[model samples]
Target: MLRYGLVVFIALLLSGCEMFGKKDIRLPIDVVSLQYDPYNYSMAELDRNATAACIAKGGTEAVAVDNEINTESVRWAYMNFNCYR
Candidate 1:
């Protein structure tokens, strides 16, 4: 009985986890973290996404400023945006 309960619990736990799901698509910029990159997104897509996010956060526009690198060796092409209000 104990083994059966453990098996059921493990199944439920694993079922709730997306172990085989697709990886999270990289974004051109993260508004909250102020992290920006152009890894998998195109320039147009990045601009649109960043602009939309900035506007959603009450900013009037988003301008790509500079490039920066994080400790993880990830190169951010557009480092961050200078949100215009």
Candidate 2:
């Protein structure tokens, strides 16, 4: 039982660290809904980073579309942005 709990804890910890660096924004992704794990990040930060990425990809503007927070299963939040060229 104790071993199982420890394993679960480690798994969650590693998963949460998935966004440790700028891996999500390293590539030139499409100007669509950019889903991010808001576990240790702020919405403003996410938006700023995403917009910057868009601009770097030659987008004139990056407007946020929908911002929703899910409280049900697989709780998560999305930062949708429409990139205008």
TM-score (all chains, Cα) for each model: 0.42, 0.47
Candidate 1, residue 36: lDDT: 49
Q: Give the Cα error of residue 26 in candidate 1, in Å.
A: 30
lDDT string for model 2 (1-85, tens) is 9999999999988887885743544332457566677565676877787778788878766777766666464546677787766
lDDT of 2 at 7: 100
Candidate 2 at 77: error in angstroms?
3.8
Off by over 4 Å in 1: 1-39, 68-72, 75-78
lDDT of 1 by residue, 1-85 (tens): 9999999999978876766665654343334224445465566766677788788887767777665445366665344665666
Q: Candidate 2, which segments miss by more than 4 Å at Cα?
A: 1-30, 38-40
Q: Any idea what lDDT model 2 has?
A: 0.70
Q: Which ten residues in a row have the lowest lDDT in candidate 2?
A: 21-30
Q: How many residue pairs in model 2 have overlapping backbones?
A: 0
